[model samples]
Target: MPARTVPQVRRWNCPPVTRENVDWAQLATIDLARARTPEGRAEQVEIARDAMHKQGFFYVVNHGFDLAENQRMIDIASVAFEEVDDEEKARYQARIKETGTYLGYKLPQYWVIANGVRDRITHYNFPRNVHDRNHPEALRPYLPEIQEMVEFTHCTILHEVQKLLSLGLELPENTLSDMHPFDDTNHSFWRFMLYDPRSEEEERKTEGVWMKGHADHMSFTALWSQPVTALQIKDHDGQWRYVKHVENAVIINCGDFTEYLTGGYYKSAVHRVIKPPADQEGYRRLNLIYFGYTSDNVVLRPLLESPVIQRTGLTKVIEGEHPTMEKWRKTRTAVYGVSELKKAADGSEYEIVNGVKVTHHH
Candidate 1:
């Protein structure tokens, strides 16, 4: 008997974004170098704090990743998807690993808690880690161009995140550089290529591929979504407001990991993507390549950085600002994940979401 051949079927084809759709000339990005200056960086730290506190999503322009590289990764993924067989595709379905890492790719996960809803998009999910290192999930070489692009993106964002964490905690730069950039021991990343709808269906059904309003799992997420109009974020009033897409922009959002780390001045906002009222043909949303943190390690601790804020003015705000870091954390934690995490003193054994044991040693 011969081995069965896996099917290779692809039904998605959309044009690379053009001027008529998105006004890219008007889009702007925060200067990376300016953000590095002491005063400017301080303002950005505050901006980060306030952005999370005010809006769940922030539009970032001028990130260092080469625009050509970004587009190249997208093209690479699109080509790869078309080239792979069905069995190869099936390898990506979500499954648990003994090493506390999820190595498989999965479609848009349809959970029961989706407010009686499910999304209409599919994706290629992969966990991230250092290459050739001893990890629960080993990251071997796949697509060179995509790997390089993602690495550059990850390093750039990680550097910025380290700065934000330090500024939030009032720690010296040297103090943080001593520790690993992001702890891969227990920390993980879920980066994937997402496919948005082509056009809205006449009758929207529950079985198609799409994105629903849900908060990410990391404290911060750096995403490069294809220029499309489907992504949306929830307002303080809980309305799903549109997030206008811009080329060369990476949308940053707060997530559960940060909600846990910040202990609450920041926010992880709820967001989604789907068919809008105007376009009935469905579109593909390409989350070209981005990264997020895992749930096992980072702690949600309220940072009291400002010497004055910590010692004197937590209860005394100039305006309607968050009273204390703890208060902010509680608020974000509520939105990110209501379930609590219990860890052992030595930072090893801990209780997971379902009260199951998840042990990892430092």
Candidate 2:
């Protein structure tokens, strides 16, 4: 482990972002302050359940942290990317291809976006327990802040949402939260991501897609709102709609693991990032997100004990023996950027991993 160094404030000018007019998707919004009471929790359960069953995406406000706190993390992330030397970053490069863990820096131009053109996205992932690993000198001083945000997101926000989901499923309040202990070994991580501006010709070659449309492999994802308007989600009608940026709100979405746990009752939202709007094309898009994974030892099976699931007669998403979180995470992470896309029977793109079929929508 590396010791913490004196915090150095690096001066890097982050480009300003502008919002443009676009058709934004109308999503369910849940207020966490109201959720603290029993009556409010009951009301939120119905709203959350409907959102999960329909689109698997929603908005959460009054989450205790305000827009200023969100911007502080983004500022630190910008400095980490802009000020860190390339030579130093190489020493901590992610071993996603070999080790199947996103625990370090991932350089830009790593993934194939379209037509053989690589992506212009760079990201750094800090695991749930930040102190257990080494980081760049630029990020060492801010490790405490990163750790605080990680714990707060997992223990405070995620647990509250999980309890509401459990109630929605007619199960005990702790049923879902128990599966994800904060101190347990899991693949959960906080990601600092940047989308570098690309030339119009390069963007055209990639069909205007920065990231392909796919569902996250984890259980839940909490994305802090930012100004750049590039994120979009595939609605239930198979239409793509822009995800509006709401200040001081965290966007919550279910993932494939959640879909499996609920017996496909809750579908995972498929989302993608495209070229920013014309007004924001010259500016870099910075993002802060936390991915919550189940404990390594937990099996990827539906909770058949839930009365809601029992009444619906839903079965497991994956048949036969279920894979543990460790196995599933490794398998999915190993093949993500390097896997060749295969055409499915319905004209959609897909990849098969561990005998399971995962779809990728264009």
Q: What is the lDDT of residue 290 in candidate 1?
A: 56
Compared with the true structure, all predictions reach lDDT values of: 0.48, 0.86
Model 1 spans with C-alpha error above 4 angstroms: 1-29, 96-102, 108-119, 130-142, 168-186, 196-209, 277-280, 294-297, 304-362
| Model 2 alpha-carbon miss at residue 42, Å | 0.8
Query: Per-residue lDDT tens digits of candidate 1, residues 78-179?
Result: 643455555765654544322333345544433321234443445554445434233111122244444466566666764565465456556664332233
lDDT of 2 by residue, 105-127 (tens): 88988888787888888899999
Worst 10 residues of 1 by lDDT: 353-362
Q: Over 4 Å off in model 2, which ranges? A: 1-19
Model 1, TM vs. native: 0.66
Clashing pairs in 2: none
Candidate 2 Cα lDDT to native = 0.86
- lDDT of model 1, residue 10: 38
